[model samples]
Target: MRIPGVPPAELAELNRAQDRLSFVYLERCVIHRDANAITATDEKGVVHIPAATLGVLMLGPGTSVTQQAMMLLADNGATAVWVGEQGVRYYAHGRTLARSSRLIVAQAAAVSHRDRRLDVARAMYRMRFPDEADTRALTMQQLRGREGARVRRCYREHAERTGIGWQNRTYDPEDFDSGDPVNQALSAAHACLYGIVHAVIVALGASPALGFVHTGNERSFVYDIADLYKAEVTIPVAFDVAASGSTDIGSDTRRAVRDRAHDGAILHRCVRDIRALLLQPGAAGPIDEAWLDEDAGDDTLRLWDDDGAELASGRNYAGEVDF
Candidate 1:
């Protein structure tokens, strides 16, 4: 007998991108399916999680997930990410929620055009420095320099408020422990932020590798998106956690970031910000019209036409092609 995959109606009932949790981290547990929910069984006990409500599932070291559990996660449009031992480093990610290619197409067009790309980059800087009036005359480099100064000031202020050491941001990528207490906390905090940002990016069907300001890395777009919230969310949280002088700074930082994400509705804000950056202004079409309201990841595939337009898929165009 064929197993019933997630029915289209059930998939529609799953939580929207903005309404879900930012992410959930699981480690050293056996993740298996239990009806509609997934269970994580450890030495202590089994905990049941409603898989449909889960946004991103981070599987860390020593975790064993069953096949049925994976099926449920995919069926629910929930992204599963394989993470490092501490749950900070990302190894890989699972399926995306989006089935339409509209957001990515818009993203590519924006990146390909120099003026549009610069405008989007400047808008990103504006998101970071909302109070900075009159940035229209500033170049990208100048904006970046100003942003750096602003971030530095944010760090110093947080340090003073939390009584944490105010030092330069320094970290050895190869060695997490090599950084100062605050730096280590910052790294851990940033990792959580990256995970949430990445989940939103993929869920929206946008390319994470294509970035406006950040470059090269596969997670360049993830970094660019996460930077919008660093000063307001991660930086202050990192410093506060560092000031507590917890032995398990990484774990503490993750929890704090998660709490902040919940309080700030980070996922919702992320969806809005990404849509604003990528979606074209005054774009016309069924797909564009559908997205203008909010993010709706319906599985509507279209065929690309040579004349820079899209046509409905699944049509027999042999006669038209011959002509």
Candidate 2:
């Protein structure tokens, strides 16, 4: 899957750090390898996508990517997601970045502990409402009440400003076409946000099901994270697009959502916020010499030999520790 013409050192560097490219949206395109670059060809023209620098690739309906192009994306740590119309509905996703599992272990430990889970939930609420003096003390019920009120107010304000008729937030998953343009646009915009947040969650090696405020679903954590930016990002865009009376509201909504994500630096903020919420003060400390030294001893568990053969010699018997 290695691209030719690119030096090994440069490829190594690209894999080692985050890429400058944030997100790319493509639809009805054919992606394949073109020498050292991954090119996407459509009716418009053929364009090269710097897979190494890309954060997320949204493959909308009708997109066909070659196996070579997919392998290149995985090798470069870029996430590829198959989505529905206007990148609103997520269908599937590619491999995540291969990174340390320590962060995920820490997250699991926190969520498994009952009190710690509540604390994490409170921390999430505090993050969403930093100015509220009682955020830390508010119970989960209180937090939910406040969040509901706040969101309703946001909908009302946006509706008044944009002159779009506002009603209760409603959508039928079974019938996407049933909703009005505004409701449909909102659904589309939120789906895009979820896709972006899902990529970050996977990149960090965190569990999407292990959420703080949201639970029971596979993308519980994705929803929890996406909610933080909905007010500032998708809500306004949905309202504005609906107000414009555009024929293709979904496409317009996607463009606006992408623009907001870039302008607001939402991905960077998401990374920082995730760390702040999960890696709280004193929850875990820096790795020290002792931690590294544990792996240096010969008594360390070895499951396989250098030649890929299973080694049963290391198993401990009734009274003896085999080495």
Candidate 3:
């Protein structure tokens, strides 16, 4: 009944999504389980983190994590991500807390159907450009064009405002340092955003690859969702970091992005927006506010009924329906 390291210990009991921490980044440390908390020890010293409330544990370059630490994280429904060597790229991640297939099922249904896929893409565009009242009628190519122009204008405006150099948005995933300061900052900021969005998508039992706006890549849906906030979250931050002339652009950009995301209440809004996108259509009505607080591993399974209602699962209905 008690959560491990969080004060008063109430995570496993209540499992409130907002009660958890957004993320914690650790590098060049040996991480292991210490009592109810996780300990990260380095030449700098040792720090203890509340594993119960941790959402994503980003293990960066020169980091070593013990199996005991990983087990503790898994038990507490925490996500552990192994990041890039210089720490600006995403590599892999540990398990998510999702046990229900409701969101993923909805996502698959929408992605498989052509009209539903376009509708989801339009909904995303609407979320990005809330002022635009005619996104519903825009074709995919038109939507892309609008988005491209908007992003270009955003970059130009930010560059002018900050007095920072901006030629174009270019990132070499294989080499994070090949780009200039602004580009490096942008890449780092976006990686952080991608990590957060990917964490949320998997936590809600949605496929990060089955995207509506993007495709082919393993994290296509992560890109789709992260693009929703790039203009407001990462673009300006990257430019501002470059303007400050920070020697360590990656670290500074990440800190700025983290602060902005927190101040903007992005985590809460991310969950709410994801639910609005995937869980709305084919439902009886709008989802309640309490759905945002759903605990991982609730484990309710139902048969997908294309006709209407949710049928009971774990039964043979071969004789009841047609082939």
lDDT of 3 at 29: 90
Residue 308 shift from truth in candidate 3, angstroms = 8.9
**Candidate 3: segments with Cα more than 4 A from true spot:** 1-15, 282-298, 301-323
User: Which pairs clash in model 2?
Assistant: none
Q: Cα miss at 139, model 1 (Å)?
A: 0.9
Question: Residue-wise lDDT of candidate 3 within 16-106, one digit each (tens)?
Answer: 4445666777888999989869999999888999788777788899999998898878777778888885457778888766667778878
Worst 10 residues of 1 by lDDT: 282-291
For residues 1-323, write the lDDT of model 2, one tens digit per residue.
87674332223355422233446788898999775567989899999977776778889888999988887777777788888876767777877563455556667888888777777777777667767765656688998998998899999999999998888899986666788989988998898889888887776567878887888888888998899999999999999999998888777888888888888888777766666566664322332433322122233334565787745665555565455
TM-score, cand. 3: 0.86
Q: Each candidate's lDDT (Cα)?
A: 0.85, 0.75, 0.81
TM-score of 1: 0.92
Query: Ranking by TM-score, best first?
Result: 1, 3, 2
Of 1 and 3, the candidate ranking higher by TM-score = 1
**Global CA lDDT of candidate 1, please?**
0.85
lDDT, residue 58, model 1: 85
Cα deviation of 60, candidate 3, in Å: 1.2
In Å, residue 220's CA in model 1 sits off its true spot by 0.8
Candidate 2: lDDT of 91? 79
Where is the poorest 10-residue window by lDDT in model 2? 292-301
